[model samples]
Target chain A: MSSAARLSPSAPGLSGTGGHDDRKVPPVADMARIIGLSIPVACMPDVVANTALLHGYADLVGSFVLPDDCEPAYEYVP
Target chain B: MTMQGHKAGAALAIAADVRAGHRSAVSVVTDVIADIEARDTRFNSVTRILGPAAVAQAEEVDKAIAAGRDPGPLAGVPFGVKDLFDVRGEVTTAGSIVLRDNLPATRDAVVVERLRAAGAVPVATLNMDEFAYGFSTENAHTGTTRNPHDTARLAGGSSGGSAASVAAGLLPFTLGSDTNGSIRIPSSLCGVWGLKPTYGQMPLGGVYPFVASLDVVGPMADTVEDLRAVYAIMAGGAPVGEPDMGDVRVARLGGWFADNISTELRAGIDAVMAHLGQDRVIELPEVARARASAFLISAAEGGNLHLPRLRRRSMQYDPATRGRLMAGAMLPAATFVQAQRFRRWFRDHVHAALAQADVLVAPTTVGVAPRIDQPSIVVDGKTVSARANLGIFTQPVSLAGLPVLAAPLAVDGLPLGIQLIGAPGGEAKLFAVAAELQRAGLAACRPLEAGYARKDS
Candidate 1:
């Protein structure tokens, strides 16, 4: 049997090896509701990845890149 | 002692007398068992003793040794397996009353089998949080597992028994599983060494599940070498032979690792970094969110695993663990999926970042072990869950399925440790770094006060 079969309750869960399958994925909005922590702007990439395939939404074509002046730290080459 | 005996002691520094024929494994085990009997009343670390069976196993090892047979490296060594592990013919109570009348395991856990294959003998089942959920070992079912350093404080959980047993010298080393800092938290709190090897490097068969995705079995000992030895044996890998600590390149994880930790813990990390002469601190991005994501995944998966039990036997579990598991059960499946997906992204990012660094350092626990009922401590002027704070530095790494060693750092009288994390399947590298830390006076492990003396029979 495959490793997935060996695991309990074929839900899409993180494997011991740190990979994931499309089994029983936990709901994103519900999790945020439970955690109740602010979503740092630093987490945009994670948010994008987590939402890409939710409810058959395949492509997130918009660019979230900021203008060079948004943060002077990365604005220009020294 | 012969060569095999020498090999056994090499890890714990107990080999000198054994090799010199001062005492045999049988005698050592007998003395340790007696000590446990005397100390466990106060410590409550050992749930059930395998006295007769353990004695018999030790005698068998002695007989084999006398017959001039080599029993590999761990022959005759007294070891403890956490209550969550199945050890054939013993009730795997998992520190709960629900399994009080459960049948004994018909076979040993894979880790136990591997240890036995190397000639190690199982002595007792260590205490833990019921079903390995909580960080403090305040098991309402089984009495709390106390810190050996300060009985008034906790030994950190769900590997509380394993950590306490090793810290108290009841056993030289013990097996433990980490879902979220279960192994490392207690090891730090109790002033011993605990390794959470890269996930899946050690087999999980015969061990009860906590969070299937995050649970991993490793060993806790009083020394890094012992941790390495036990890891090699349990994982079915050959030892890295002799450690070459001089060549280790250390990584001091700053940013999220540095900001929230306590002054004492930060001092410990700083001391170790200075001693290693590679104090360049590197930022590990996304660690904060990663840790939060890990908590989300652990709860959702753990609840899913025990949903039936929660529905029927809710009252059986410790109230703290049961509540969390129930909440996890309520987590919409999408969030759990997002957490796992986030884990995939985080793992890849961590691997890429670690390619330039051999190991990353952080405080094993956010602060020192707290008194069992001491409530909460102020961290950065904010009040957090007393139990959750202890595992703050550890949860993120465990989520990434990376290896980590909670190696003790020097503290005045209280015990504190720094966590050394490495990429997946990097236990050998983690140990090599730990050995270097020990040499630099950043880490030390000593056997607990001699608990009992050998009785001449």
Candidate 2:
């Protein structure tokens, strides 16, 4: 799932202490290692799951490109 | 009197009794600690009872009153703090074993100190989602907090224990932080009153951070009056009555907020609208996108916060939370930047919509707490994990950083809640609306009673 139409129809998962599946859904484990994350092979399924979810969120925001004048919402300065 | 046996079971009631010599502060705190020990086994809302320290603080309140001095507005009231807030002399775990070895806090959180000054005793540290990350308080390290209304159900999370404790009548009120619906989700699930005040309106000094840009600490209680009183103290104001509701323009939210709701929730909103004579509805543009933006921002910010720790003890982290954080840390820089920019645009439109109404009414969650065994909620006709989808209605509003008060619908079935949203710095307006609902019996928390359960039993 990467965007609205591309969004994956969902289901509940990882029923408490999820089982280990070494299969990588999208090479997210390798990406984790690239970013200096020492993720275990057993965590491959979870890392993959997270990758898809984050990417879906990214795709949603990717549509509305920031205009030049839009202010960055950083720390809310009171 | 036992806290649960009190007529209102609110902070102000207990405080007035203690100050007027009707009850002793020592006895009140002691009775509450004992009651929690005996009863909280079903709810699992409390992590550590302050024990001797709590009684000691209560004793000071008794001393102040005995010496002919005012012991403060919240005199002798016992309240709990979510474990993320530093309690002096206690190692603030933020509900994780990883922080078990950290040094104890040297002093109390600013809010804790302020409450103590007003004679509120910090009786215990309530449980939370580790690092305040998840909506389901199913912490891998700490045991899950069960909803008091039905021990078989899940307590909405990150701030689950705080809301559950208040719902269980174990405390008058409890403080919880809302990054994105932590306070509201659990409050609604547990059928308690909760306030996620305008972002950055209150101090977050000693509270643990989840998404810094969106995090704000607030209070949950069994009554709106209690929430209003506690919020004032937390914001460094004095105890006050409900604000004027005159000339307040109320409207229901339509479009995305109007769809995908359970029948009971929809009926609850209709009942409220009918009571208030508000037929007008306001719609915000691209709300699904707004919700997605909040999700992305939370992941990126939370991922960055734990990146350093994940480098060393990644497996020690909760698998669910860890995976999300890892994914977020790797989120493209462009995505984070664009979300922030969208925030500016979305916030402007939300504010513009508010110019037409003083308060926006919307459902807090689709319906009641999901069963722990089956942790799923129905969203747009699909069943999704309650953990991920419980925040759908709440997250979109979080994007705008407006103030929201989660008032449990006065339904005898499973607890349902509604969001009373106000513009930024518009807490007074929200309070006024919530008070009116409470007065009219349209909104009231159904605190856990002995043998509380559905008839399906």
Candidate 1 regions off by >4 Å?
A1-78, B1-22, B241-246, B452-457
Worst lDDT window (10 residues) for model 1 chain B? Answer: B1-10
lDDT of 1 at B20: 38
Root-mean-square deviation per candidate: 11.1, 5.0
Angstrom error at residue B95, model 2: 1.0
Compute the lDDT of residue B202 as modeled in candidate 1: 78
The TM-score of predicted model 1 comes to 0.82
lDDT of 1 by residue, B382-413 (tens): 66567756666788888788888888775767
lDDT (Cα atoms) of all candidates against the true structure: 0.71, 0.83
Superposed Cα RMSD, model 1: 11.1
lDDT of 2 by residue, B1-457 (tens): 1213223537888888889988888888888888889899988999999999999999999999999999999998889999999899999998888788999999999999999999999999999888888888998887899998888999999899999988887887999999889999999998889999998888988887789889989999878777888899999986455456767798999988887788899998999998888889999997877888889899999998988898888888887788888888877788888888888888889989999998999998888899999999876566777888888889999989999999888886778999999888888888888888888888887665421111111
Q: Model 2: DockQ against the native?
A: 0.45
Q: Which 10-residue window in model 2 chain B sums to the lowest lDDT?
A: B448-457
Each model's DockQ score: 0.03, 0.45
* Candidate number of the best lDDT: 2
Give a tens-digit lDDT track for model 2, residues A5-38: 3223221232322334332134565667777877
